[model samples]
Target chain A: AQTVTQSQPEMSVQEAETVTLSCTYDTSESNYYLFWYKQPPSRQMILVIRQEAYKQQNATENRFSVNFQKAAKSFSLKISDSQLGDTAMYFCAFSASGTYKYIFGTGTRLKVLA
Target chain B: DTAVSQTPKYLVTQMGNDKSIKCEQNLGHDTMYWYKQDSKKFLKIMFSYNNKELIINETVPNRFSPKSPDKAHLNLHINSLELGDSAVYFCASSPRGGANVLTFGAGSRLTVL
Candidate 1:
């Protein structure tokens, strides 16, 4: 019954610049987890960052961070100082607390141009 | 050492053929999942196993079957493969009480000719 949406099909950013990929989800659960995963050319899905709905503070992992607006039901990823290696397909995912299932959004193909 | 590994990284076969993709996780987690990434880059959960017990089974075709012999192994078997079955299948695992931080394996790309 939960769904995630990534409106941007593709995105591009120049090296050393910043780009933000938008994501929105619909869930009735009050406690949940949100994640951002990156799949490189090798097709290995790597966890980028994660945020808990109960945590008011957003999550940050080095150059990658999330702007989680719980009330707005929006979780966007911002990649700062982007590098060519950051080019990959990024996915937004949601999982309810105490559940093993995850609902993923349609990926956003990101290209970090040098 | 690979945390999660799936065999047959690339499987190309003719339609109506049967194939199996093996998955093993060394993380000792209680939960494992099979996700399908279609050509449109959409990832959907197909099945999940917790300690060799079926947990989540999506509305996938009956041709797709999943077997979990143990907590660390989950294998997927597809019968009468169709052209639409051509997609990347990913195996992932995560700790039961954790935040659902999935550690995924290198996907197995299935191409049906």
Candidate 2:
């Protein structure tokens, strides 16, 4: 079975700074995808970024980017120039190619301080 | 327009009661899913449907049932709700094929007293 792990249970960063959330996964499948999702107090799960296992270059979306290390099976999220709006519970997810199951890691509660 | 919408946004019922959560997606995606988020924020997949066909059914209790009239809609009905059933239910959808990128609804919070 594929499993996703997020070690940081809580994190905080000052506004305009940068923060990184760690994620690791255990999977034997070579074809897979990774995603980072943000859930605010409104309880709306929003897509942040995604990365493909075949692509070595990490995926970047505006201020959010992923540090995907496929060989090491590590996919971490880096939030640059963090803003107050970035305060939320961030989740790291994994889905094997052609599979409907999306395994999610325990979320990291991030707080952007002023 | 909202890509994926679910209602009622909040449901509160007593023990042994029955409840249902309706979900619909306007994104024209062929796959829909039901996920449960516990109080600790752990999210788990309950059921999944592709083109109105049951695809993935997790180890959820038999008290929970899911229905899909079409590819665009998936509804979950729970019988004999228990205190442990109190959690936030999320409806999500993805495109027709193997790409599992998902768009989720604003969750329906269920409280079983």
Per-residue alpha-carbon lDDT of model 2 for A6-112, expressed as tens digits? 99999999999999999999999999899999999999999899898999999999999999999899999999999999999999999999889999999999999
List model 1 lDDT by residue over B27-94, tens digit each: 98999999999998889999998899998999999999999999999999999999999999999999
**Candidate 1: DockQ?**
0.69
lDDT of 1 by residue, A1-114 (tens): 899999999999999999999999999999999999999998999999999999999999999999999999999999999999999999999999988779899989999998
Off by over 4 Å in 1: none
lDDT of 2 by residue, B1-113 (tens): 88999999999899999999999999999899999999999999999999999999999999999999999999999999999999999999999534568999999999998
| TM-scores for candidates 1 onward, in order | 0.98, 0.99
Model 2 reaches what TM-score against the true structure? 0.99
Candidate achieving the largest TM-score: 2
Runs in model 2 deviating more than 4 A are none
- Which 10 residues in a row give candidate 1 chain A its minimum summed lDDT? A95-104
